[model samples]
Target chain A: MVGVRVDGTTRLMGIIGDPISQARTPQAINPIFAGKGADIVCVPLHVPADDLATVWAGLKAMPNLIGFGVTLPHKQIVPQLCDSLDPLAARIGAVNVVRREPDGRFRGYQFDGQGFVRGLIAQGVVLQGRDALMIGAGGAAVAIAFALQQAGIARLVVANRTFDKAEALARAVNEATGTSFATAGAPTPESGQLVVNATSLGLNDSDPLPLDVSMLQAGMTVAEVIAKPEITALLRAAEQRGAAIHSGIHMITGQVSLIADHMIAALG
Target chain B: MVGVRVDGTTRLMGIIGDPISQARTPQAINPIFAGKGADIVCVPLHVPADDLATVWAGLKAMPNLIGFGVTLPHKQIVPQLCDSLDPLAARIGAVNVVRREPDGRFRGYQFDGQGFVRGLIAQGVVLQGRDALMIGAGGAAVAIAFALQQAGIARLVVANRTFDKAEALARAVNEATGTSFATAGAPTPESGQLVVNATSLGLNDSDPLPLDVSMLQAGMTVAEVIAKPEITALLRAAEQRGAAIHSGIHMITGQVSLIADHMIAALG
Candidate 1:
């Protein structure tokens, strides 16, 4: 079987999350490491919420540790642990990746939003002049909102179960992008050319779709952030409505190459 | 091209040492993990002396981390960090391995000495009725002395640059084994049927032999603990004298299987 060859000198990177067993970065990224002939292996570290700070401190002090991928409860909290943050990650108040600089400083970056945008672009969806309706204002949603704005989306509507959070996310995205392109409102498929499900709503089989499928129109593109069920209810509904659909797996697979690049550059 | 396959769920084991790039445990033990179908990988961790406590504490907190191998400067210090130690390791005041228990407690064990005895036995050398003359009273020497006593060696003579340390090691061995089987003395090939160079004397090409080569006899067995050169100057001299000789590689190769067994058992 083609796989990573770990030895004494192999560089180490890890993904930190409470429930780390299901993390897919190892399989996704290790093959890339093997293909590139990079002597690095990414492992999953189960760091509980309470032990996050301690574990993060420990990992940073390791001389051979190159970087880390942050997820779930860690993404939002890890930005505080970094020595510096990418402007996007700083504005979003979350970090999905931490790379150790050549001078040993740990710098954080958020890849979720960028990954989502890349996935959409890879699927031939044009974001430059399109409007987007984003559901959920949580960590993933915040990242996707900023990334969409950065990708030159003409306008964005942030909708959430809590209107205040959506408003706050919209404000943050607009302030960071220096544009009045984002507004908080209820999701309407007819109002935007792109629809995104950025919440945990589609994780369960019986969970309701994040947005109304009846509003979906042909030529519109829909995407979901939940990867376990690649075709979430929201995506399935959009697909049935004759809209171009992008599954959650694309978001993860899209980031693998970019993350690998960041990690290799950081190794220097 | 055969190597360990690492994934997110692979249990992590590390070897802690200052200069860890040359450590061979990753190559030796990882193959064992793969062969046994154990989802485990041993990696080399370059943990400096100052960062040992912080790094070790962090590693222990990782829920999936099973155990570690302590080498060089960390060996003696690591035993103090363990919740409990194997009886032999406790007596020798050093630990070479630490295994996490099912209840999450970390216990340490010293495999160096045991590995040496096993290597000799594997080579068909009889230890039960043999007398040994060991050079050096450092960490490796102390372990070998204790293991030789435990292996039913008839007697032991420890020689070192500093006589007090050798005396102390001999005393510890006798006290721990409840027998007057070991003594501190000058290096003499005539004193014991088996002569061991446990010191770092043969590490350089220009260094003198640990003992007088002319003193070696045809029926004697000579062993060295240095593995890098495989056949050290002492072993070469022993070979020239037509005495039975054991290389330092035996010490490492013999321990690989035993260490693999301990690590797998600790996964429980």
Candidate 2:
């Protein structure tokens, strides 16, 4: 029977995305807000892509609106609306979190990469001087690649169903990191110390594993960025192969705490 | 340590007003939502007057937004944005509640007057064929005057510091009721079975009483519409003179259930 105790003075926060009914941020962060005794509740707001700018403008005008979480279609667009972006988010070309500064300016940051990296680190997986292979060149893939590069990974390979997208993401990462570490490659689990599934393939029960998990080896780390069905087929296969497995829930759980901290500090 | 349990699917309700820090609607209604086993949370939104149109447009586009409560500066303006208004709200020219119909249309309603009348009835004060004196010609007073007329009150005398405003309101009420039962008068407790203070005078501790409570008789019923502090000097003085006293909380308590019911039905 414990419920959210929101009143006139409770500060406002929301997660904005198209088809927002599937978002888990509210359930993840609201409980944290309660635990911290923060008078804030984050709700899901269904802001279609066409209405993103208009809705964002209106939300910014609200004096009690503390901040918001950005997801899906809007993530790449939100960075353009921010007054400033964290260097990492700028490099990734997307934003997953927006904080309203005390001076009333909005600053955007991407937490997907940080969340993934945190989850890996929590499982005792080291990225520094390691070779990592990322599957997909979509939004999540790009963020994780940049985060891995930033974490000092010695080499990074991006594989995609569309080779052009993988090459483009590799170029972006290489240019941003000032290194020749990132390259486009076909899906493989044979040579990397870290393997990541950053695609939507693992979301459905019938969806194929994003990569060749049959080649997974002991001591190698496997990670997923998809949240639904926390233990994806990829993770299960990696687990059975004696590979250290990181489920999508770890990324969400890790990001929730970081995002909450960033939002609270921004409110100050 | 109980906190609001909000997930992506939780329905949203908000109180829209300027200077929203003092509103009690969220505290009153959110608990009721929990009691009803509804996954809903009401929050306070400080929407300034200048951004009302833009923000309202954004709000209307939110597919999960159930409804909103309107307050000062917005109450009179919200009905214009709604697709329809309840007849009582249309006549009162103000709306305190709005519900989003299943057809995606918003309907406006005013519960203040009904709440006051309900409170009066709860205190065993009958309005039918009874003479009533209402102090103030402001928003609350106008609504109460119309509600009293609708309840079959034989006569209503509206008194205010500005006689012109009182006279204008009396004209509107009389025209709406198609009867000359309401008139402008000076503040007095001398000749009515029911006397109500619908003005802001009772909000401050040092302000003078809205009416002459010295003339209150044992058979008279006295009521105040200010919710804070519950009891006002006028009600205290009336109580001392053995008059039936109705505190402001009764109006709020009486309306909470009614408003909750309206919002829930609107969600369907």
Best by lDDT: 1
User: DockQ values for all predictions?
Assistant: 0.60, 0.59
Residues B1-268, model 1: lDDT tens digits: 3567766677889888878888888888787778899998888887888888888788888888888888877987888889998898888888889989888999999899989988888998878888889999998898899889888889899999999999998888888778999999989877348999999999999998889899897889999899979888888888998899998888887787788888888666
True contacts kept of each: 0.64, 0.73
Screening candidate 2 with a backbone cut-off below 3 angstroms (N, C-alpha, C), the clashing residue pairs are A4-B3, A4-B4
Q: Which ten residues in a row have the lowest lDDT in candidate 1 chain A?
A: A186-195
Flag regions of model 1 displaced more than 4 Å. Answer: A161-164, B161-165, B190-192, B215-218
**Model 2 per-residue lDDT tens digits across residues A64-100:** 8888999888987899999999998888788999988
For each candidate in the order shown, give its overall lDDT on alpha carbons: 0.86, 0.85
Top candidate on DockQ is 1
Listed per model in order, the count of residue pairs whose N, CA or C atoms clash below 3 Å is 0, 2
Best by TM-score: 1
Which digits, one per residue and each the tens of the lDDT, describe model 2 over residues B96-215?
988888998888999998888877777677788989888899888888888888778888889989999999999998888789988999887665578889998889999988877779
